[model samples]
Target: MKRSLIIANRLREVLLNGHWIANTNCKEQILSVNWMQATQKVGNLNMIAALTFHINYYLVGLLTAFETGKLEISDKFSFDLPPISSESEWNKMVTDFISNSEKFADKVEQMEDSLLDQPFIDEKYGTFLRNIEGVIEHSYYHLGQISLIKKLIMQDQS
Candidate 1:
């Protein structure tokens, strides 16, 4: 298998699979979440919607860069937040995230393995690997928040 394909597959596991939500199973996390109450300063900021958006953001960026050797979205708009109005919207965001992720993996599979280590200067991150690894690290970071937030939200409901 190509290195890009390998990386993309691992990323897929993390996103659709349980890696997004603690030890939760992939089948469970895919569309199992309810909408998070819009970011209330008094409440948790890392809602499910935000995390979903973040995952897609990185995946798209990764494919565009490492695969096509370019960026799909501008840096300014890449990190923008998702709209969280209701549970339905959150579910839709989750679906969009998953779909886009698969597309990203497909794109990555087309690239040469040599591209993975090629130096590309990012405006903010300084290195291409750093940027890619940052996405994985960021996803894990938010996954922790998602797990904690889910607990807090569910606990309060009881």
Candidate 2:
């Protein structure tokens, strides 16, 4: 099988479906929480909604790079999630995340295997595969946080 296909599958495994890794995907976790629960803060940790925005922020930036050949994302702005005050607002954010996740995987799946080894946008940023894998690792890290936060929130409510 092609390397791109494998990478894309791995992406889907974390973000969309296929739960062999963490036993849960972003979509499932995000969907499990209501707007109030998603926006609730547990101590100093970020809320679920913010984490979702952070992951989707990178996904959107990478997807833009994939399409336009320019990587314009900055870490400083990655967590600048707009205030989500209502269920509709929260739902829209989740919907955008799911849509972007699908698009990101599709873009990867269509890539030529050779492109994976090439530097993404520039030589300093390393290979496309490295950045793609970073997304998966970063996502799982935050997914674990989300799960823990959800538990903490639930426990607090009880």
Candidate 3:
């Protein structure tokens, strides 16, 4: 398999399912969660919904760069999640994450392995390989937090 395909597959696994490193994925861990549960805080940590948005923000940015050759993410605004007033709204965001993950992976797979060595958009941001693999690493990092938060939320409900 091509290196791009390999990275894409890893990205898909982290965002969706069937990842070997973690038994549960981001979708499995949060997609079905009720709005109340998703928005609940575990002490001082970010809520599940907020974390979801944050993860998707970078994914969308990278995908944008792939499509338009411009990286348009701002860390300042990345966490600005809209009001998830109902389960439907929450589900929409979850679906957006899934959809973007698929699109991003597809785009990545289309790139040559040699492209990975080139800067994502410019030299300051690092190579495409670094950013792409960074997304996987970032998603896993948040997945761990989501799992722990879900546990905490469940324990509270019990």
Candidate 4:
């Protein structure tokens, strides 16, 4: 298989399903979480909803860069998760995540293998492959946090 397709599939697996390391994906992890638990502040840790939004924020930024050739995201506003006080709102966030992730994966899949080595928008930002891989790494890092937080929340409820 082509390198671009491999990277694209790997991204999809981590975001949606069948990730090798986690053995599950962000979608399953986020959806399995209770709505109330998502908003709960466990000690100094961030809310699950906030983490979800943070993950998607970068993905959206990368997608926008690919589509519009402009990178307009900053970390300061990345974790600004909307109020998810109701099940419907939480469900909507999850739905948005799924839709956006699908579109992002498709865009990445369409990239040429040569494009991977080319710098992403700017030379200082590094190559497309590096940025893409960074996204996957970032997702896994946060996925671990979400898993631990969920476990702690479950234990607290017990």
Among all candidates shown, the one with the greatest TM-score: 2
Sliding window of 10 residues with minimal summed lDDT for model 3: 11-20
Q: List ranges where model 4 is wrong by over 4 Å.
A: none
lDDT, candidate 1, 6-89, per-residue tens: 666655656556443356533245365566532322263655556567667777676656657576667576548756777677
Which of 2 and 4 is the better model by lDDT?
2
The weakest ten consecutive residues by lDDT in model 2 span: 18-27
lDDT of 2 by residue, 1-158 (tens): 99999999999999999689888999999999999999998889999999999999999999999889999999999999999999999999999999999999999999999999999999999999999999999999999999899999999999
Report the C-alpha displacement of residue 117, candidate 1, in angstroms.
Answer: 1.2
Ordering by lDDT: 2, 4, 3, 1
Which TM-score value belongs to model 1? 0.71
Per-candidate Cα lDDT values, in order, are 0.61, 0.95, 0.89, 0.90
Model 3 C-alpha lDDT versus the unseen true structure: 0.89
What is the per-residue lDDT of model 4 for residues 74-154, given as tens digits with 9 covering 90 to 100? 989998887888988888888888888888888889999999999999999999999999988998899889989999999
Best by lDDT: 2
The Cα error of candidate 2 at residue 153, in Å, is 0.9
Pitting candidate 2 against candidate 4, the one with the higher TM-score is 2
lDDT of 1: 0.61
